[model samples]
Target: MTYFKVLFFTLCFLAFTTHAKEQPLKLDKHLSVFQPYLGSWQADFDVAPGTKPVQDVGLWERALNGKAIRTKHSINEGEYGGESMIFYDSKKDSLVFYYFTTAGFYTKGTIKVLSPTQFVAYEEVTGSKEGITKVKSTSDLKDGKLVVSTSYLKKGEWTKPESRIYTRSNQAVKFK
Candidate 1:
C-alpha cells in the first residue's frame, strides 16, 4: 500500500490501543478514605422523641499505639464521652464504626463506596435464621461538606431516616 495510507493506519491503531488500556479510577486502597476521616468530628443526631437529648460529640485519640483509631466522643457540656470503633476495610472498600453512649446503647455500622469520595452503609443481616439484628448508618462528602445520613432497614429497605451535616475542620493527618 502507499506510505501515506500505511502511516495513517499505524497512527489509528496506536490511538485505539492507548485509549483501551486506560481504566477508570476506583477505591483500590484504604488510605484513600482513612486519611480524610482520621481526625476529630462532632455529630449532631437524634434517637426518639422522649430519648436522650440531641448532641454534638467531640472525637479524639483515646490510644496512641494501635492499628485502629481509638476515639473519645464527648457531649457539649457533659464530661462523659463515648469511646468508639474506627477502622478501614481494605477488601470491601469501606470504613467500620461503632459506639456505646451514656444512655447504655450499642451501635455499629459501616460506610461503603458509592463513588470515590461518596459512601453509604446500609443495614445488613447475618445468620441463617431466628437470630439477627439490624444496622443503620451512612455518610458522604458533597458540595465541599461531609453529610451523614442514617436509617433503619428491614429486608433492605429504609424504615426510619435521619441526617446530619459535618464540615472538615482540621487538616487531615497523614503517614507513610
Candidate 2:
C-alpha cells in the first residue's frame, strides 16, 4: 500500500508539471514600441556654458513577461534617480506610465504614440516641488540618440521646456 501511494503521487506531480509547461505565454504586442530603449543609455544635459553638463544614465528592460517595460535611471551619479513602469492598456487603447523617484515623488500618466520611435506622456502634478500643474514629456529617437523634452504648464501657461539627449551605451547598466 505504501508503494502504491508513492507511485500515485509521483504520477500526479508529473502530470501537473507537464500541463504547466504546455501552456503558452502571451505578451502584449504594443510593448514592441519600447524595444529601442531596451538597453543602457547615457545623457549629458547642457545646463550652462561654464558649468558641466548634468549626467544621467538610464536602463530599460522588459518585465512581466513582456507585458511591460521598466526603466531604471540615475542622475549625477546617483544623486537622484527614479524608476518607471510603462505598459499598454488595451481597454483604454492608450499607453500608461507610472513613475516613482527616490525623492518621494510619484506620477501617473498616459502616453500617445507619435511615431515608431516617438511618444508623448501627459501627466498631472500633485506634490512636485517644481510647482508645475501639467507636464508633457516627449521622447524621440534621432540619429541613434534619444531626445527627451519636458514641458511644464504653470497657471495655464506653458513654460520654457527642458530637454536632454541620450546616447546608446555599449556597456550594460546595473540596476540595484
Candidate 3:
C-alpha cells in the first residue's frame, strides 16, 4: 500500500511539471518597426537655456508574450518617469499606446511606422494642469543612435520643438 501511494505521488508531480512549461514568446510582425529601439538607452537633454543637461535612461522590451512593447524611462535618475505599453489594435488597424507618468498625467497615442527605423507618434495628454493637451513626436534610429524630436500644444498654442539624441547604454531606469 505504501509503495502504491509513493508511485501515485510521483506520477502526479511529473504530470504537473510537464504541463507547467511555457512556450517561447514570439514578437508580432507588426512590432518589427520597433526593433531598433528594443534595448537600454541613455540621453541628455537641455532643460533650459543655461542649465546643465539632464540625463534620461530608458529601457524597451517585448511584453505580454510579445503581443505588446513596453518602455520605461526616467529623467535625471528619478526626478520624473513614465512607462508606456504599445499594442496592435486590430479593429483600428493601427498601433496604439498608453503612457502613464509619475507626474500625475497620462497619455494615449497612436503610432505610424514610416520605415524599419522610423516612426511618428501623436499623443493626447490628460490630467495635466499645465494645459498641455497635445504632443507630437518623431523617432528615428540611425548609426547606433536614436533621435527624437517633440512638440507640445499648450494652452492651445504650439511650442517650439525640442530634440534629443540617445545612444545604447547599460544604465537602468529608476523612479523616486
Query: Which candidate number maximizes lDDT?
Result: 3
Q: Global CA lDDT of candidate 2, please? A: 0.83
Ranking by TM-score: 3, 2, 1
TM-scores for all predictions? 0.50, 0.76, 0.83
Better of 1 and 2 by lDDT: 2
Error of 3 at 135 (Å): 0.5
Single out the weakest 10-residue window by summed lDDT for candidate 3. Answer: 18-27
The candidate scoring highest on TM-score is: 3
113-164: candidate 1 lDDT, tens digit per residue: 6776677764444441423256566667667566776665555555666688
Which digits, one per residue and each the tens of the lDDT, describe model 2 over residues 1-176? Answer: 99999999999999999998884444478877777678899987778788966788899888899899889888777778889899988898988988887777678899998999898999876667766678898999889899999988877889888889999875444334
Query: Which whole-number lDDT from 0 to 100 does residue 155 have in model 2?
Result: 75
* Candidate 3 wrong stretches, greater than 4 Å: 1-25, 47-52
Candidate 1 lDDT trough over 10 residues, lowest sum: 167-176
Residue 97, candidate 1: alpha-carbon lDDT: 64
State the lDDT of candidate 3 residue by residue for 17-99, as single tens digits: 88788643567988867866888999987687888679999999999878899999999889999999999999999999999
- For each candidate, what is the lDDT? 0.57, 0.83, 0.93
- Cα miss at 52, model 1 (Å)? 12
